[model samples]
Target: MLRRALTNQITRQQFRFYRVNRSNTVINFVPQQEAWVVERFGKFHCVLDPGISVLFPIVDKIAYAHNLKEVAQDIPSQTAVTMDNVTVSMDGVLFYRVVDPYKASYGVENYGYAMQQLAQTTMRAEIGHLPLDRIFSERAQLNAKIVQVINDSTVKAWGIESLRYEILEKGDIHLPQSVMQAMQGQATAERKKRASILESEGERQGAINLAQGQRESIILKSEAEKMEQINKAVGEAEAIKAKATAVAQSIQMISEAIKHENAQKAISLLVADKYMDAFSNLAQKGTTLMLPTSVHDPSSMIAQAINIFDTLTTKRKDMKSIEASNEDKKPEPEK
Candidate 1:
């Protein structure tokens, strides 16, 4: 009776302990998988309080998710290198999380470890090549490069996915305001000097243009005056030529008229009328008049008429010779 009682109690205790263990254990451990069994078992994998699980009890597979905050802090500052092997440093914050749970859990020893290691090295390399100002100027470029380097190096291997990064604060870099102000002032002065120089050049060019305009105006006006004077001289010369031409035409007409018998009769009639007027004027003035004393003295009238004809012919010939000589001595026409 005592042995049976002890056996019953032992059986009940074992049942309770098994039930408790099965409920509490995160990974069920059993030698066989059964559809109706409350728990199934396989080789147990360590789950990081929040890591991976095998979807099938008997199938060997691991999958999980990890929060970045559960693993490590955001990256803030980092270092870099240059081709010359010089070291340059900068500060920034890094953000990352697990994108692939399988890789996050199994592909790498630690996701945070890979990110940190890569971030430090890449930051140093990038910062070394760039001047400090470029890195310090803005977070946009710095974050992109940091995430790129981290993702490229670790996503395939370390299971790290870079979400974002940012510049925190400069670590060793320093700039003095006085020096910056001096640089700004120098730049301003240089701009002003250039502006002043351009303005002076423009003014000088304007003055030169004004002088040229005045010179051109003077030259044009002088040329106009010269043309006017030349025109005046040409006009005077034309007037003189016209007068001389008229005189020549008159002399030619006279020579042609003198060849006509009627013209000779007209001239003789005009001379007789002129002699009558001269004789009357001489008689009124009591001047002596040469004439025959009576119609019987015919030889005296002929002698007086002969003397008057000789005097008039000599004077008329002298006037014609003077006119011809004047025509011969004139300058040639302008070409």
Candidate 2:
């Protein structure tokens, strides 16, 4: 009975120890930005979050530890052929983060490396679709397209969240000497074409400005001539107005003076004076002169001059009477 009892006690102690060992396994404090994949007998059991955790000692084991942090990887330079058949080498970097640790561990082998290769291959394929010049001008678009492609291909398989892919540099494209010479010639021709275009534009603008200036000058000259003509017309009109006014005043003074009793004697005096002046002018200015047989016949010359003056006066009175009659016969403007 004592030996059986001791064996029962030993069996009880072993069972308790086994139970403790099986249920008590402590995982040390995990970083806040890290996670661990837990597996039971090589199969997925649960995901271990941050902080200490306890699990069944023999059945549950930490399968994989993953860092939930951002990572940057450099892509090595690789040669790619463009659509133009130009071979160019390029290098870049990629930024990614692990979203799901279980998938990161089990989805693909070497997630970081697989992503790098994917990025390279995708970039090459993208490069092959574009011309050489387009590759340079559309670098940002190219990087974005590469990132999208890599993410699309790797998100489910590699569990990697591709944030960005940046192309750092592209090496000089290796080309045949003939291609290089052709490129150089093409560059020279393009530069010359642009320069000629600018020069022609400048000349065209200058011609336009010169023509505009000449047009303005012509307009100004014509305006000055128009003003001069206007001023000359005004001056001539004023001179004619003054002459008419003087003639009217002289005619009025002659008509008023003709009522005096000495008017006939005044007329005879005026005629004799005019005859003397004419004789003096003829003797001084004429190349030839005719002398009357009776140069002393002053009375006869006076009588002839009086007769001509009277005939002119009579004609003037007749013209005045005709003008008055015509004015009376015309129709008047309506009031």
Candidate 3:
């Protein structure tokens, strides 16, 4: 082993003197997502990319090495007072990456600590501009504003790119006991008010429905009554018409009988029969006393009925004779 070491040293020295040591130089295998800053004689040089690269042992050296992968920084909780004098402590995580290794190595001493501090300061300032209610509701906006402020100011000069900022914990944000109680009471009152309004609306709808139903019921009933009355009146009118027709038909038959000069005698006998029946009914039921008057005799009643029929027949005959005479007086149509 000692002999091999001596041989390797002689070989390296020979290669260096003959200007062939570049081939034997140590090759740096930079892994993916990483960068190496090579400096020649303590001056700025090119950034070494992925894969194998070499720097002269005596001249060029890797001055700075940086991992290009994303980095996360956990920020400790800090108290922040809001515009309305509400104090809240908040903690978060910040994600960043080295965009320019030269600037990251030279532009700032420590970009991670600087990013953390800037994030805190910006967070405090942003919180101070907002009210307590907004702090709870606008957490996303708060994180975005903090990221933007840090990225625009310190992160830009530091060659560090801010990817994201997430609030890990929202520390206790306190309000006065009286204020909390008052808010709770207000919420209760609002809920009760809504319930009352809904109940009243339901009752109003019920009343409207009931009134409409009653109105419809009344209208239907009135229509039914009107129809019944109309039907009754129509029935009465039809009955009157049928009775009149029957009466007229009976009169026509009587007139035919009168032509035979027997109608008057028949009517007299029929009237005497009806009087006998009515007197018999009165005597049986005893509804009235049937004291017979002097003119109540059946023979007398029959004689009177006969006289009345004769007078009516004579008047009818006279009217017919006058009608015949008038027809004869009218002029005949020329044919």
Best-fitting candidate, scored by lDDT: 2
TM-score for predicted model 1 compared with the true structure:
0.38
Q: Which residue segments of model 1 deviate by more than 4 Å?
A: 1-174, 233-241, 261-335
TM-score for model 2? 0.66
Q: Write the per-residue lDDT of candidate 1 for residues 224-301, one digit (tens) a residue.
A: 999999999999999999999999998899778888776755655555566656756877887676644643554454
Give all candidates' CA lDDT scores: 0.60, 0.79, 0.77
Error of 3 at 7 (Å): 51
Counting clashing residue pairs in each candidate, in order, gives: 10, 0, 0
Decide which is better by lDDT, 2 or 3.
2
lDDT value, residue 12 of candidate 3: 45
Per-residue accuracy of model 2 over 85-129 as CA lDDT, tens digit each: 987788889999888877887897567656667888998899999
Model 3: which ten-residue window has the lowest total lDDT?
A: 15-24
Q: After superposition, which runs of candidate 2 have C-alpha atoms over 4 Å from their true positions?
A: 1-33, 40-62, 170-179, 246-335
184-247: candidate 3 lDDT, tens digit per residue: 9988999999999999999999999999999999999999999999999999999999999999
